[model samples]
Target chain A: MKILIVGGGMGGTILANNLARRLASELRSGKARITLLSASERHMYQPGLLYLAVGRMTPDELYRDQASLLEHDIEFHVDPVEEFRLDNNEVRTKSGKVHGYDILAIATGSRPAPEEIPGLAENAEQFYTEESAIKMFRRLQAFQGGRIVIAMGVPHKCPMAPLEIIFMLHDYFKDRGMLDKVKLHYTYPIGRVHTLENVAKWAAPEMDRLGITYETLFNLKEVDGAKKVVRSEEGGETPYDLLITIPAHRGMEVIEKNGLGQRGWIPTHRHKLTMEGRNNVYVLGDTTNLPISKAGSTAHFEAETLGENIAAIVKLGAPVRDYDGKVFCFIEAGKDRATYASFDYQNPPQPKAPTRAVHWFKVAYNKLYWASARGLL
Target chain B: MARRTVDARGSFCPGPLMELIAAMKMVAVGDELEVLSTDKGSASEIPEWLRKARHEHLGTEEKDGVWHVLVRKAR
Candidate 1:
């Protein structure tokens, strides 16, 4: 069996590692082969980007060479996939090289679609990418204190990040003795601060205590950088000295170009994680059009089920496992305190109060992330 | 009962933990290493790591807003 895994992000790496470990016997006997295709040699620790934006981490600490994360048994290709020929069971890369696969897993992650929202590409700052996070950090250092808006578009990746950024800002300004001068505003498209009701219940009181204004149902419509104002589709407008936004998110263009995606994301079975109308192909992580937060932890959890299913299908001819939509995320409150929440499709997350212990756990998880890619954690 | 002290103050989460792990690699078995960190997570995480790694955790103490964690390399 020849398996091709696309995208080297959290989902791809974890799946590759899990499959390689579980199918070691078949792999060593030449009955199975795994090939991982990625566009870049760099594997980013995305959660670290939040700390990077606050000037607490450096870029060197946030990324690692992808080669270091893979084992010797898997073939790693550092080439961009140009298109998927699902009808022929083949994948074409940007270099025009074609690879055949018996099984294909599309783990290609999502990216910030600033173009979806007017003026966001040019006007607002974001922490979703390494470059933008660094830019936000520099801008934050020079901020003289005024209205700062952290806005979001619906279905964005890492649903908890904007809230974490706001909390960090609260501590940053308080430490600098400029908390009184800075007016912090957090705007979301939904009716609540968080998608998870339990998380919102835990976070709302904290936001009130920090003196940060939480505005709900304020979907971003346009950003006027020159005028320093942001208008919501609901006819609400807020002026800001600085705007940090979680822009609209969409899957990679290649998926859409190949007609394998709906609105730039591959449609998959909610529990089976199998691509719709394609039995040999599967999808996970941000690439799938699932109503789940596009977080690294979500990918980690999804890989657990997806990996087992792939192994079973390869060995026994059918997948036996089903995904539960499990997800957990650590919410950084401020300073040294953090909280955590865990849930699945059936149950809402019950979050714990912020504490220094949970903060450290998040920190340790970042370090363990390196080991995780190799299937050690 | 520490022969070396690692000050990981002003650093964030895994920073303090990484420092302690690096310090442990340099010390001899049965030798003690103390970590001084301002990151509150270190107060709990360092001991957890020590227990998992099979190292002897002496204890953790807080002084002047800093956490002083003691660990002995137990081989």
Candidate 2:
């Protein structure tokens, strides 16, 4: 059996590692082979990008070579996928290589589509990638303390990241003794400060205490970089000396080009994680059009279920596991403190108050994540 | 027991743990090393790691909002 996994992000890599361990006998006997096709050689610890933006971590510490994370049994292909020939059970890469697989897992996670909103690419800065986070670090160092606006473009990965960035900024400025010189503002497209009601309620007083002006129901329409203004669809406008925004997120163009996505996101069964209308194809992580936070923890939990199911299907001819849509997130609350929330499709997360211990846990998790990529933790 | 102190206060998690492990390498067997960290998780995690590594855990104490963890290299 040949298992072809696309996109070597958190989901793809973790699933590959899990499969290699579970199917070790089959792999050693040449009964099954796993091939991971990734566009880049580096696998980034995306949650660390927030710390990278604030100078807490360097760029070198944020990622590892994808080859280093994969087991010897799994083959790594550094080629971009051009198209998926689902009807023929074949995948064509940009390098003109066509491979046939018995099982296909689409783990090609989403990317920030800055072009989705007019002028956003030119006006706002983002911290989603290593380069952008480094740029934000330099821009922040040169900032002279004026109005700073942090906005979200909706459905972005790591929904808690923007909030963490804002809190870290507060601590950064306060440490520099310029807290009073700068005014902080946050705008979200949703009706509340956060998608989770419990989190928003817990964060309301904290935002007020930090002197941050929180605005909701502000959908980003256009950015006027020259005028240093961001206008909402409702004609609401906010001006800033610096703008840090999370751009709109969409699935990879390759998936969309192959007509596999609904509005650029792959549609999958919420619990089964199987691609709609396909039995052998499964989808997980940020690429799926699930109403869940596109965070690493979500991918981690989903991988657990999907990995088990794949193993069962390959060996027993049927899937025996189901994903619960459970997600966990650690929200950095500044002052070296953090909070965590965990929930699934059936239960709403009860907000836990921020604490110093939680902050340390987030920090420790970053190190554990590297081990996890190698299937050691 | 003479103890050498490794002050890792204000450093993030794994930072303190890594510092403790590095400090352990420099110390002679039976010598104690104390790590001071403000990262709250280290208060418990350091000892857990020490136990796994077969080091003698002297215990942990919080002083002035900082955690002081002591361990003696056994191997």
Candidate 3:
């Protein structure tokens, strides 16, 4: 069976590795041809970018050469996907190359589209992407004294990430002997500081301790770059010297252009990670609008299931296994401490709980995760 | 003499752990407590945590897609 997987991200790479192990016989005999395509040579651990923004992790630590991470059997194409034809089971590349597949996996991840919001793209700097994070870091470093605003965009990955960065920034300035010279402001569209009110209960007081000013329900509409002003949906304007926007996110345009998006995300069954209304197509990682939060740990859990299910289909045609939308994440709160939140989402409301020990647990887990990614653990 | 049940099903990982910590706070010594966790990780995590905290591990069983982890306040 010819398996063509688009986007060599955390999901795509893990799926490829898992398939290689599960279908070793098919892969060795040339019966199964696996092709993984990506737009870049570097596969970055995006979650690490938050640490990079605050000088906690180096850029080199956040990314690895994709070819080095993959097994020898899987064919790697460092090219962008132009279009996909579901009827023929073929995907066309940006260079006008088309490849056919017996089965397909589209893990093409999402990206921030600042242009969707007028003036924000041209004027306000963003910190989601690697380049933007690095640029914002430089901007932060050069700042002698001024008002710094960290604005949260809606539906972004890792919902609590922006607050973490802001908190770290507060700690950063205090250490630099410029705490009083700079004023920090946070603008969020949500009713609370974080996703859960209980979380905000803890985080709000932390923000207060740092003397940071935050305004909620302030939906960012536009930015007047020339005037250094941002207009919110509530007919209010906030001016700043530096505007670090989280920016809006969407499924990779290729998925949308090919009619893959059901509701701004690839529609997949909760348990199987298989396209709900389609045959022989599976999606993992951030592109799928699952019930859980979009985070790297969710991708890992989904990859573990989808990879096995696909192999079963290729071999014995076993019924697909289900993914329970498990998410394990670390919410970094400066001082080299991180909180681990594992969400097991099911039907019927259940009270949520948070733990302080999660801070140390995340630090230890980070070491293990990177080690495992490099095949060391 | 009495048991307290914390329904943490439908919540995610550390959610069950947090519930256990909170429940331990309110329960008297030797009181039984049950945590219904939907997260598979919790099945293992809770047992390990209880052992470390010197609490008595009653048992764990999967029911209706959730793991019912029962523990007793031993400390």
Candidate 4:
């Protein structure tokens, strides 16, 4: 069996490692082969970008050589898939190489589309990438004090990032002794401060306590960079000296170009973790149109399930088990305090009050994430 | 009668439990497994999962900030 995994993000990497281990004997006997193709040679710890924007972590600390993180037997490549010929059970890479597989897993991941919103890319400060994060940090450093408004769109990766950044900013200015000089306001596209009802309930009063003002039902219409104002579709305009945004997210361009699914998200089986109609093709992480948080943990759990089922199909002539849509994310409430959310498809997460101990654990997890990616933790 | 110790310390929430479940698959129906995890959620979650999977939860104890959850395979 030739197993091809496209995109070496968290989901693909973990799945590769897990499958390599479970099929070790088969691989040695030439009964199975595993290959991974990714866009970059460096694997980034994406959650570190938030810390990067706050000056808590540096750029060099967020990456490792992608090949170094993989198992010895797995065939790793830097050529990214440009076309997905699902009907032919193969994907064509940028290097004009087409690889066919008996079983395929697509985990191309999603990209934050700040350009989707007019004037957002030019005016607003975002920390979705390393360069943008560094720039945002520099902008924050230069501003002495003023109105800093947080604006965001829906269906973005890392559901807790907006809240985490807002809270972190409160502490950032507080530490700089400019808390009283700056007015922090937040605007969300939804009817509440967060997409999840419980999180929104917890955050509204927390913002009120911190004096961080918020306006809900505030869809981002456009930004007037010259006037330093952002007008919402809800007929409200907010002016600011600094604008931080979590722009809307869309799946990778390759997915759309290949006519796979709308907006890059391939229709996937929520439980089986397979492409809706393709039994041998698996969809994972932000690549799947599952109505779950596009967090690393979501990918990790899905990868685990996919690994077991694929290995079973090779050995048992059938597969067992299903992905339960498990997702766990730590909410960094501030620089020193944090909490977490744990839930599945049938259950919604009930986050607790933020605690300092949990914050330290999140700090530790930052370093431990590499180990997790290695499928050891 | 067989027993296995799965020391899953330093792992995050659900990871420890997942490791224990993987171990459960390799053991016999009557085998007992002890999972050691540092994540606070695992202390309760391991037993919760055992209950749902129809496995017998032997006991759970926390020692030096690490939790040890014991269970026996039922099916």
* Index of the highest-DockQ prediction: 3
What is the C-alpha lDDT profile of model 4 across A173-259, one tens digit per residue? 999999989999998754468755577789999999999999875767789999999987557799999999998788899998888
- Estimate candidate 2's alpha-carbon lDDT, on a 0 to 1 scale: 0.82
The reply for model 3, stretches above 4 Å from the true place, is A262-264, A347-377, B1-75
TM-score for all models, in order of appearance: 0.82, 0.82, 0.77, 0.83
For model 3, what TM-score does chain A reach?
0.90
Q: Clashes in model 3: which pairs?
A: A271-A322, A271-A323, A338-A359, A342-B12, A342-B13, A343-B12, A343-B13, A344-B11, A344-B12
Query: For model 1, how does the per-residue alpha-carbon lDDT over A30-134 read when each residue is reduced to its tens digit?
Result: 999999999999999988989999888899998889988987798999998998999999999988899999999999998888877788888888888999999
Residue A39 lDDT in candidate 2:
98
Interface RMSD of each: 21.3, 22.1, 15.0, 16.4
- Residue A42, model 1: Cα distance from true site in angstroms: 1.2
lDDT of 3: 0.74
Q: Report every candidate's CA lDDT.
A: 0.82, 0.82, 0.74, 0.86
What is every candidate's C-alpha DockQ against the true complex, given to 2 decimals?
0.01, 0.01, 0.06, 0.01
Off by over 4 Å in 4: B1-75
List the TM values for chain B, per candidate: 0.91, 0.91, 0.93, 0.92
Model 2 chain A weakest lDDT span, ten residues long:
A188-197
Model 4 Cα displacement at A183 (Å)? 0.7
The worst-scoring run of ten residues by lDDT in candidate 1 chain A lies at: A188-197
Superposition error at B27 for model 4 (Å) = 52
Off by over 4 Å in 1: B1-75
